[model samples]
Target: MKLLFLLKEGFAGFRRARLAVTIALATITLSLALLGLFGLVAQNLSDSFQRVFYQIRLEVFVDPSLSESDFQTLKSEIERIEAVQSAEYISPGAALQEFEKDFGKDLVAVLESNPLPPSFRVLLKTGHSRPEAIQAVVRRIEALKAVDEVVYPENLIRLLDKYFLLGILIAVGLGTAIFAISTLLIFNTIRLAIHSRQRVIEIMRLVGATDAFIKAPFIFEGILQGLIGGLLAAGLLWLAGDLVRYLFLPGLSVPWLYLAGLVAVGVLLGCIGSYLSVGKYLNA
Candidate 1:
């Protein structure tokens, strides 16, 4: 019975201050929408970087004059390294074929002799894609007897490292700003609702109502507004998902789990803001 009365009063507060509630709802919706968009972009960029990282591999060219047994021994030794995932041997003929496939030119036909060095296309383990890890792996492989040269994309690794760090800092800074602004707006909205009903609060207090009862309805009102705003924001993101993918990231897709988390955050923010606002008024 008490819960029902509190819910009724909460809905009634919305009717009492329709314009203020609308502005608060709109602010929450916009804030959440911006946050969701930024999250999607950051996710896509991180994925792209991971894809590039996995593509990086070391090309270990070995001495071509070794016997078949020695070559196999060298390949096995390279594969035994801690960071090496697998070492695939490329023979002179296979190397010539790959050169032709990549450059659309028959190197063997042009030179009339296959001079391409036999190399091991060395793939690293999952957690060993960074520049430092790759360099450490290279140093170990180069120390082997038959390895002529160990080469990987040095500049590309450094570039990815630099950009990925920059992206993280930017995402954290913007996300914090958006959350702070949304909290302030919701707090002010609840505060205004309390101010508008100041006389009723005093009358209820004089008639023996506790502070808890007086604050319950305003908290409920804030939560309802937040719920509506979250729903609207999630719907907007769903509708814009395809367009965002086309314009920004071809592989971008907003998962249902992410949208659910966004809604949860909105509800939590509303609860905290309203609780703090009402607490301030009651204490004052």
Candidate 2:
């Protein structure tokens, strides 16, 4: 059958251009592996950013003269704000304890009095964790009569926001470069295969073979190369997962779906490369 012949020719093409095929396969594998590694790093950094965002709390210090009843009213008012997730009251005694735990020094023993102010550790909703949102929330809380002051790590949040944007730009630039390089290598590999088989192609043309029939074998060869390279890349990532986790990110994981998608990308790249190369040659 013609199908069997095409398949046979496709596999044979590999032998006809061994070095080119090897270079193409290696290029695809390396490119995809680099992409996978970058993906892992991005995922870990995202997780770390989320954890830091959640830990960003607004320390709402209250007047020491506030009565327990007034404190409860103030707490209710603070919690009623749309952006506020929860407000936990920290009494002077508890604040002193935390200070000692953090700095290893008892303020009461040094000063003979607890100068720590009672405060509400306000956690914002995830949606309102941005610097501008936090600032707006601070403004609203600062208006309350019972609140003496509102403080947060404004500089830290601004720096993180800036860094996150820079990271996105770098990722886009690197990903584009890798994709272009992989496509070029695969295209060159298929072109070399076609050139080496020029005599066979001419003979087939004389024998009344259609362009489709001649192109089918080359396309199949490309798909096969991509398939093999994808599998090798996936296997390499799997084998190195433990080392990656230990050395780079402790909780990093590559999902099966992501690996499957990587394989799909490889196949698509190969098909595209072969199609372009063979079409150009036949047309010329």
- 9-100, model 1: which lDDT tens digit per residue? 99998898788777778887887788777777667767777777855688999999988898889989999998888999999889988888
Which 10 consecutive positions of candidate 1 have the poorest summed lDDT?
185-194
Instruction: Give TM per candidate.
Output: 0.75, 0.74
CA-lDDT, candidates in order: 0.82, 0.82
| CA shift of 30, model 1, Å | 0.8
The positional error of residue 249 in candidate 2, measured at the CA in angstroms, is: 1.9
Q: What is the per-residue lDDT of model 2 for residues 1-284, given as tens digits with 9 covering 90 to 100?
A: 99999999999888877877777788778877776666656666777788777556899999999999998999999999998989999999999999899999978788999999999999888877778888899999999997889999888888887786787788778767766776676567657766777777788778999999988998898888778877788778877887888897678787788777778877887787787777776777
